[model samples]
Target: MCFRKKLWSIVLSAALVLGTAIMPANMIFAASDNESQLQAMAVKSGTLQYGDSFKWTLDSKGTLKITGKGFLYLSLDDLGDIKNDIKKVVIGSGAKEIHFSFWSFSGDASLPKLAEISIPLTTKVLSGSLRECENLSVVTGGKNVEDIQGRVFEGTKWCQSTEHVVLGKTYIAYNGTGKNVVVPEGTVAVSEAAFQSNKTIEAVTLPVSVKKIGSYAFKDCSSLKKIHGGSSVTLIDYDAFLRTPWLDSLNETTMLGKVLMKYKATAKDYTVSEKVTQIYEGAFSKCDNLESVTIKGKITEIPRRAFENCTSLKKITMPNTVTNIAYGAFDHCSALAKISLPSRLKKIETGAFIFCRSLQNVQVNGGKTNTKLQSIEDAAFAGCNNLKTLTIPWGVTTIGDYAYGYTDGGGDENSERDMVQKMMWGDEESVPKLNAANIIGISQSLGHYYAKENGIKFTATKKGSALKKPTVMINNSGELSISKVVGATGYEVYDKSPYDKHWCKAGTVKAPVRKYMTYELKGYKYKVRAYRETSTGGYQYSAFSKIKTTK
Candidate 1:
């Protein structure tokens, strides 16, 4: 076994508690040693990188073929930067998956091929690594391999996945994702930026082997919704599930009491597991339908923008163990009237609650923070004219430009009030602050200086908050058509919809403009106007849709 492999063997022992029983005997027996056993499996390929000074990277034009394998690891360390012509890399010819080992491999258009991959137990697969390789597919240690370095297959085809992937304790990297994927047993750490930009993945089933998931590991997987969580999962990366719509599934189901990370389906109630130690930056960014989040864990901190822009959220309860609160963690939670942050909290980053206008009750002391309120990003609360009160925690030092900029709780905020302001978290020990008291305007000048400081809210000069979520309805007019409904955000239509909606749902605030809602109107009158709330704290429906329901 390699030196690093030996270290991992000791680290993730709990994963080993199940014994190699979950794995095939061939995998266990084949793992005797990396050298002598895998040597005879080589099939001779057009490209060969062997031994120290064995020369690195071969020129296979486009399709590089592998005949046999004696542990052939494509050595990229020696081959600086190669051209993109070598697009299709084929690994086959009795090489089983044993030929590859630890290391990062990248070249323009690398083998997007997944035709020849399998676990020792023998799960027949027609295409391995075949999602959005765009033009890439990474293959790593075989089903039997154990304890490989975490980053051995970092950003290659091996890292990209759209479905279930099986790995042994020896397998190293699993940084890829798709809509619905299952991670087999014996896996360990899921490195950082591993699943970045995988937009198609809908569900993920993590194996008990995973102990740590790196930062942004699931970032930008917008459609992701379901997660078959394992109790062994511990460390989670920042923004690990950013922009993922299915995050709420991690929350416990109403009847089931499970954590719903990304909200996407048919469950009515959801809860989070206490074993979770952290909720990274933007852990649930843009998940508009989350009604409530009750974190029951031993978490010590909540990072920046942890729950920012969750418009449909009603409330959240932060665990008592939390200490640090990063900037803009909950800036635009429009409907979030209350939050349960513990009194024992220590620091509050700049603009932590900048635009949380609907935030009616937050129990923070008048002055209790370690750092000054840093520069407030633009529009931190630009459209939040409804914000009524401000309760500054102690120890606050600085304040962002838009720290208290806009004040209207209703109506379209004028351009004058929309202008952003920047206010840095000042370095003052005393939390001397001013509540909206009665002010309601965001100035362009304030946006300038306040946004100048780094880490503060950074809104582009563009009026971004002005846009609202559109509601769409899909009637029987066409074969599965989608039309925008005026006010329906997310519908956890479990059996009424097409695909199975058993996946847990967080909630979607607004339905898209003509997408998938069932309209009950007799005359087919389509009224599509933005839902406006009256000053009395009630909803004032906007003008009807210009065009009636599509005939």
Candidate 2:
């Protein structure tokens, strides 16, 4: 994935440079002989002038034709005095999108003569371009349109006659006066603001085919108390059910299908249920009363700002299934003191734990042997003044700027003062250098580079040993003997067979008794490394010796 991204960036850079060299400045499309003949019969003809992509020609019959590739940029002001003269609009097949400067074609002013529009099959989204055009009655060739946002045709003749406006598989708008509403089958998506601000809607039933509910889909429906039939829904945008009685009625936890939408309760302690597989962004944000949370599920990520401003939250337990800690997931959780990351965690996004002043400890990979962590983005642990030391794993290749203990006066004066008090109170030994924290990891790792670059104190966990590598000898009887090294406390034996993908630990032999034997030694390669016990009860290892096999 990284290689592909780099390759795509290079290709885009080269394409941009080549395009700049070949394209002329202030260039406009020159009309061909056929186009010139067609323009002669037109009432008006001009380029969009914003870009060379679009051109417009209004015929004598009051038909406005738009030809464009990529996008059609239009506005009521773009028409100038000819706004009232347009009766029909035909968009070219090459146009994939239409962007209007204003929300709609007719807003303060009216396009009374505009009655018909023909969108091409290539256009996939219609976003409030012809809304409130009261005279617009006919629409054609929008079979490929998949998304419709805002009130695209609120006052139009086509929308006034229909209660439920569905385009393609998308439910675009609700114009019904009924209290109980049932969305038709085969509808796959509910567009943004589809049922917004409708006071009479008391109940809504979605079809099994509906997979997504856009933001503000059912917002401000005061009387809406029930929503049924969302078994097939996989995605529900934030605030999809905002300001509705149904959402307010959900006490404690609000869940829509497999997604946890909100935590409404004032409880001091909470645990996410295992049934929920996903969590929406900011689900528990600003929950000041929440003190402890235990997440139990197959959730792969903690969404952005999921627990921001949880001032009382001090503890959080995450399951091993979580692999990503998204950007600002725990921002300003001032009381959070310690966190244990999961073994499968890969990346810690920017500002994930920023301004958590009380944070003192962070254990990565759950203190396990192997880690899959790759990167720790900028300011991941910034403003964590209380964090004295952090141990980075060897597998991590990138340690971003200010990922460790860093303090600033960016509206966090109280935290900075607390750190200063600790330093002045003769407890300075527990506090790390200002803006530079103590880091512990294997020698020559990225953690060392980060520490050296930031003037932080670094301690190598696996330092080079003075003891020489132990020699491994295998005889015909498959008895392997490892020659002992001076000043070594023990030797670790590793073996790799033809079928093995990695070297496996065979056994460890104490010093002065280094002779070792294994039954499955035949057709297997073996190596040995000597280690000396450190004062901290850890081992410092020498480089592995040459591989040996039984004759």
Candidate 3:
């Protein structure tokens, strides 16, 4: 994809740039700011005063010169419509420091029409300075100049004007049009958008001294085949080579610094490297056939949308270093059956696990005392219909809307009960902070008057007896039976299938039942699980027991 270059406005104010200063209020000088005076000076004399601090002059050849300055704030917008009249800029030795924060010169295109800039050794161009002059080729006389910012001359026709690689302190651009390019040693960083949209150069070699590759450095380099050196490279920012054909050559791992940028593989099982401390947004998303993932690292947060829409992912083992799960991190993963949240987890952002159709269990640090969990954002567990068991930690003080409930007018009888039946334990005072207006199915069953007073609707009663998860086993006659029930009213039997999400209800077990309830099956050979009722008159169900298969 062709990423558009970022545009920065030239509008500057004294408060926005520095603290307070005595200068013209507007970014570009208007007609009242001596337009006729500047035009007459361009024709007759060559010098004019910009307030009292400095003097600016223009020669017959359209070469502008700025003489004396303590802190010169000369943006291209200061020239306005007269910007195209100037072809060269010369900063004399009298100037001490020059700072330019804007670069977008307005016209048919955004880049400025001027070419060539001559700066003395005493001046310095501050960081975050963007220059997109495409025809500027003569950039010299900077032996004593302070460190220049990267992308100072980016998107310029001078990028291909020389065969030798051009660098600004540590940045690399103007890599030339050669089929093979070699970077010298001792380069520290490649600035953002340095080599953006270059469609040439087949191969390149880098020295071991290079580090830090910036965002979109090699974007749109379609003919570029390979990058030969990245041994010392760390900290490559987002979309460094976004539209490059080289991404197709990456197979097992595409890592830069401690962040795992992208993972593209056909394997069923994948393991993250021990050195990875962060996973960027959308790194492993849309992997349709992944089954197991093992992360053994010091990663602290799962970023936004890190694993969304991975349909076939079933298992993931998170290390204890993880503390925060960002918004939409694992949404729409249809095959994930269960997950053991890290013990040190503190925050679950909005919609972290929404729409996971087969997610049955989430094991966190349970119980009503001193848990690490502090918040669960809106719809964090919404649409997880099969989620049977959960332990809301005591430390949870904030719960967002629809945190563990069904959407209005959505879900079937079993699905609705999936929220209403599950057990929740928390400090009584802290759970009241949950927003009642946005919650429906599950929050209603809690019977917190705060939920009802806030307009939550539910048919089930609040009070209920908690029941333990049951155990199911296949008998010698090939009949499925459930055992080990404490407080029960009835039982719901389910047929387990690998692909199908809906749990097929086989039969029911009423009260005064025997030690074991047997349900004869038309034997094909599949697994079965069951949920035992806990409340007498309320709608409360235990978690599904371990599956038992017919041999």
lDDT of 3 by residue, 341-418 (tens): 887888999889977868877777532223466677767876776664455543453456557644312445564345
Q: In angstroms, how far off is 194's CA in candidate 1?
A: 2.7
lDDT of 1 by residue, 1-551 (tens): 99898976764474378766655465454456746545544332334455312222234344444444334444333222442334544444344333233223443323333223333322111112223234344443344444233333444454446333334443233345334666666667554555567777777777777766656767777777666765566556566666666554445222111222333433323355686665545657777667787878887776777678777778677776777677777777778776656756756556576656666554543223222222233334444445554344212322333455344333334432333221222222222222333321121222222333222333332221221323444355521222343443322221112222111121223445323343343333332334332232222222223333434
Candidate 2 global TM-score: 0.51
RMSD of each: 22.5, 21.5, 22.6
Q: Give the range of the ten consecutive residues with the poorest summed lDDT in model 2.
A: 22-31
Candidate 1: what lDDT?
A: 0.45
Best-fitting candidate, scored by lDDT: 2
> TM-score for every candidate vs. truth?
0.37, 0.51, 0.45
- Candidate 2 ranges beyond 4 A from true positions: 1-40, 43-55, 68-84, 94-96, 103-107, 110-112, 128-138, 150-161, 252-254, 263-278, 285-305, 309-332, 337-355, 360-551
Number of clashing pairs per prediction, in order: 113, 0, 4
lDDT (0 to 1) per candidate: 0.45, 0.76, 0.61
lDDT of each residue in 358-451, candidate 2, tens digit only: 8988998666424777678877887777888888876664566557756654446675566445533534244444554688886645566567
What number of backbone clashes does candidate 3 have, counting pairs of residues 3 or more apart or in separate chains? 4
